[model samples]
Target: MAKDYSLMEDSNRSSNRSIHDISDPSRRIVLRGGLGMAIGRLLAPVAAGSAGCASGARGDGPLLGFSSVPVSTADKVVVPEGYIAQVIAAWGEPVGLYGETPAFKFDGSNSAAEQEAQMGMHHDGMHFYAQDGSRSGLLVMNHEYADDGLLHADGMKTWTAEKVRKSQAAHGVSVIEVEQQGDDGWQVVRPSPWARRITACTPMSFGGPAAGHALLRTAADPAGRRPLGTLSNCGSGITPWGTYLTCEENFSSYFNGPEKPSPHERRWGLRKGGAGCRWHEFDERFDATRHPNEPNRFGWIVEIDPFDPGSTPVKRTALGRATHEGATVAVTRDGRAVVYMGEDARFEYIYKFVSREKIKPRGLRENAQLLDHGTLYVARFDADGRGRWIALGHGQGPLTAENGFADQGEVLVKTRQASDLLGATKMDRPEWIAVGPDGWVYCTLTNNSNRGTQGEGVDAANPRRNNTTGHILRWKEEGDVDGTRFRWTHFVLAGDPANERVEAQGNIKGDAFGCPDGLWADGRGVLWVQTDMSPSAMGKGDLTRLGNNAMLAADPHTGEIRRFLVGPVGCEVTGATGTPDGRTLFVNIQHPGERPSGRSDPEQPGRYSNWPDARAGGRPRSATVVIRKADGGPIGT
Candidate 1:
């Protein structure tokens, strides 16, 4: 969700539905025989061992065994030569969870209650979990925002209330624990009782159907069922009962409103002077014209239970909130629970939800109300390569109340105007959604520079136009994950197939990297990906021959792709996970020397990257590396 907190603007005026508004544009790229023969007949029955794939991609032979790691404007961290990379719980470290454990003071002087026990700031979407088998676990992650010029200590000068509570205690979620120390590698189990730190001022609750609606009350939450935290925490998910979802992407650039805002604050882009993290001049709930339902208690998803560090962190709201960027659960073969999500903006839409019971063999107190009862839906993608989902249910079809949806909690709080009055499909910025050991699903579209310019053109599930390097989109649903029909394609179109400007040359089959953002898939079918490309467009122009931000792995049945890791100079390789005997992995990197106004000047904090403390004027934190395998086996093998 970076790209300087996603910029915003395009408030979906609907009329979307574009793949050239189809009507035999050559049956839109030859119907089902095109996105490369429908991704080789939907990954050729999961590379032929079908039946719901994922037995770790069935004894694979070359599902990426390493070796590829080149394009790296090196300020540090590039792996693949038997692999090693270390770093760990970076940004302001400590995270020993509560009380003392302080220690992260390279002059930013900690505070805000020691930046709420440290380790928060940048590090987007992560997971880990394990326990002892992988030698320890828990990790968690997502501190998606906060650079107030490297958080405090004279950065946003004179800004007070302890620099808005240390930039809302460096925005939310961290969890920690880690372990694997026998060879002296992954540490941080410091005070571990499963560590913690769910910040932005923690305490959170709210559950199903827009919990206590009235546009989420809030005169300091008179009854919006409590939601005093979790903001901007981007892309993350892990549940099957284990818990820890996070999400909330650009929470309307931390709000500000009223200069003529309301149309529900310009359809969630708020502004009137925000998107600059002024914390509304000192957090009166980020002052959206005086707590306008406190930015409807933040674009939701929350969840968290990373083995209960004294729980309390819910915000589910039947999963509808927009701007989310990550959720990815997938279950429904009767075990109910679907999820999926995406809305990272720029023409938005691509949600999921499903649930309504099932999933029982108990865990987080018997599935904690399975995401508070669901149904959401919203995808569309049609010009032939099929896709459907629709149901943003409230009085269905155009959501009734003669349009402004009067119930299901204002149709999940105007979930992008009930997905533009149920017509949906206007993507190109979707970001992270995984699900595939081969049962498809994928996602990631992270690009969309106002695709085909302001008048909004191109489509066929976003067939590049001004899309500036993006693409991944998979799909397959028609029967499982509570099917509402599905078919999609295009699993790779990221950049450099010898580009010159054919819509930023993509269709990459290996290595080339571009915006893709973080995605995962692993229990073997590989497909990792990552890349974000933004510190003001990295080395410059068409991503200057793609030099930094990388992660790549992919093999989803031979569409190949490789480049494993490479992040540093102005970072953003973004959150990945591993370890359940997959050896190690972890990843993250985010905002490293982020500039081009996404903060970091505090008198030139190492001017552009001093990654993992390359010193000389350090401060570029946002870490998490780890990666292993120097014969410890597993990981991309």
Candidate 2:
């Protein structure tokens, strides 16, 4: 039977779970862009509903090349008949460091020093960047968090300074150099100068209006311009200009707030006691009462330079903060850079940032400043397939002193407040979004069990009740992507193919999926969807036939979805990307055998999933897997 949903879930635990805490005022702001005018753009509807997958035609990409694999409760990775998967990097694999590299310890005895140069835990969103024209490249990945039971020799029940430090070193991003080995395999380039790890202890700086804001001040950096690290990074994106965008989600649970919580802090899920991870017990900075503004420093989209590991990662503030899922870049016809983002909490809003200046392709440094100044907007979706982007800038409307927004900096720091006042449409837990080749946007509303039954009921956009299965939403800008108006529709109401709800909406043919989380569109207009379903639901109910969390391929044009690969037991399929040539595919299998009722006592054998190891007494580890066809053909062809 499924566990009581509310009791089994903590504020710290959610789909793609990451945590932090905070509090603020409830003042309202004005909406600058007229919603009435925005509706006019959608009146003339177009026929482009789902993505156009060119692969269906002759001489295009492959046409669902392999048969669908059956659902299994086995502890092994499963793929279509012609495809093969190989593990590349795991939790403790050493990449490279300032000094010498150390070997990974399977006994969980590796010191904090070793972890600095090793791959972090809970591999999440990632992207592959070709460096040597597809022969070799950099694979940038996010380490969501560490599993206390597996990270420590004796578990988190008896925490110490070293254990805390080791965990901290395991919660950021990894940029490792990978080179092709054989026709369909790749290996990590160990000790390569290009391989490096950015942990929660790495030094980082801030950019945009909120860089020097008072809310960001801390004893270590009174200027409030620099923060010590990044944590709770969930989903991510790769920018057109070559930087990696790693989003900080659910950061509110990181801080242990004051004795009396403020309304804002409560809303952000700040707890009086330390967060579940208990980092505050070792580092006072995590205690919000001691460092009141520390929690404010997180919850922003951080950009990292994969090619230059020595360069500092930056928290881009022009894109307002919340529980940021990630940021996707879309370039307009005139060269402007537009970023679409989703705040990943239930009822949170979707947002976008339009750069003030056009993109400069001269050099990285020449174009780095483009993201420093942009107009941020919150989305408001209507029941009639229309939507508007409300400007979140200062001097726009009611964003004055009366509304608690002193300036643009204040508006960004309190982004959720600003959007609430503007009446932005509340969405289900929105996660990663993909932009098809034709410019239509596809987003994953990864379920919202907390939704009420009435006004927020089944509408043209979010059409479901107690949406445990979730759905995919798509929209297109009538003119410029930065324009205030757009047309929207429900592309797929994800669920069992046999069910009436899914049959009436979803365009699935081969394999069906639920709780779509990580979404990306390859250059060929194929939409890749990754699943993140609850462990109990994996083999029961409408999802019983779906087996483990798997990655599916969907033709944007026909809306046909086919299961491409299924992960090991207890794993969440996320962090998917392919090489520039599309011959090699990289997908992360996170927290395999992480079932809520699974064994966790180290003294016992096969405590969870043996996974990639497939041994009788092996422990589960989150690792990045490489997938390719046996014939060395392009993936998902």
The best candidate by TM-score is: 2
Lowest-sum lDDT 10-residue window in model 1: 30-39
Question: Model 1 lDDT vs. the true structure?
Answer: 0.75
Q: Candidate 2, which ten residues in sequence have the lowest lDDT sum?
A: 17-26
The RMSD of every model to the true structure, in order and in angstroms, is: 22.4, 7.4
Per-candidate TM equals 0.33, 0.88
Compared to the true structure, candidate 2 yields what TM-score?
A: 0.88
Q: What would the per-residue lDDT of candidate 2 be over residues 369-484, giving only the tens digit for each residue? A: 77889899988776556678999988778787788888889899888777777877777778898875444677888876665332344433323545667777777787877889
lDDT string for model 1 (1-637, tens) is 3465346556776687653243222223211211111111222322111111233433536667778988978788888888788887888888886455988887687888888888888888888777787788778898888887777667887787888888887888888888887889889888877787888888888989889888888777788898888878888877666777888877877777788886767877887776767777767778878778788788888888888788898898888887887887756544666777888778787888888887666466888888888688888877577888888889977788887788998898888888877787878778787775335677888787776677676555434667777777776776566778887766667778677776677767667878887887666667688888787766666677899888888777767788988888888888787776677878888887788656777888778887888877568888888888888888877
Q: Count the backbone clashes (under 3 Å) in each candidate.
A: 2, 18
Distance (Å) between predicted and true CA of 390, model 1?
Answer: 0.9
Root-mean-square deviation of candidate 2: 7.4
Pairs in steric clash, model 1? 111-114, 218-221
